[model samples]
Target: MIELRSQQGETVDLICRRAYGRETAENLAAVLDLNRGLAALGPVLPTGTLVRLPDPPADPPRVAVVRLWD
Candidate 1:
C-alpha cells in the first residue's frame, strides 16, 4: 500500500492515473475500499487528504481492438 497526499482540485481518477499510470474500475474500487469515506468527500478531494494506493498490477491487461473495416 502506498500513501499519497491529495493535491488541490485532484480527483480520484487523476490520482490513480498519476500513481499507477492508468485508471480502471477495479483500481478505483480498490482505492475507495482502502480509504473509507473518500467518496463521500465528493468529486474534488480536499487538499492534503490522505489516500492509500494499492499495488499496481505487474502486467496491465490488454484490451482487444475491434476493427470497423479490414
Candidate 2:
C-alpha cells in the first residue's frame, strides 16, 4: 500500500501516470477503489488529500537459456 498526498489541481489519473507509469483503466480503477470516495469529488483532488495506491504489478518473467558449449 503506497500513500501519497495530492497536490493542488492533481487528479488520480495524473498521479498514477507519474508515479506508477501507465494509467490504464484497470490501474485507475484499482487506485479509485483503494482511495474510495475520491471519485465523488470529481476531477482534481483537493490538496493534502491522502491518496492510497495499490501494489504495483509484478515484473514479467524472464526466460533463461543454458548452452552446452560456450
Candidate 3:
C-alpha cells in the first residue's frame, strides 16, 4: 500500500490517474463498494481522504532493482 499524498484535493479518478496512471478508478471504486458487504456507503475516495490499497498479493515486484547497501 502506498500512502499517496495529494498535493491538490483531486477526485478519486484524478488520484488514480496520478498514481497508477490507469483510467479504471471507477472499477476499483465499484469493487471497494461491493466489498463493503453489510453496510453500504458512498464513494471510497473523497478528494484528500487517505486510502489504502489493501494487501497486495505475494507476487514478485515488476522491477526488482535491489542493490546491496554497499
Top lDDT model: 1
lDDT of each: 0.95, 0.84, 0.48
Q: Compared with the true structure, what per-residue lDDT tens digits does model 2 show for residues 36-57?
A: 7999988988898888888787
Clashing pairs in 2: none
| Model 1 spans with C-alpha error above 4 angstroms | 63-70
lDDT-sorted candidate list, best first: 1, 2, 3
| Model with the higher TM-score, candidate 1 or 3 | 1
TM per candidate comes to: 0.84, 0.77, 0.40
Which 10 consecutive positions of candidate 3 have the poorest summed lDDT?
Answer: 37-46
Error of 3 at 62 (Å): 15
All candidates: CA RMSD (Å): 2.2, 6.6, 8.8
Candidate 1 pairs with clashing backbones: none
What is candidate 3's lDDT per residue for 1-70, written digit by digit as tens? 5455444545545555565645364535643553453113243443455544333335523766888896
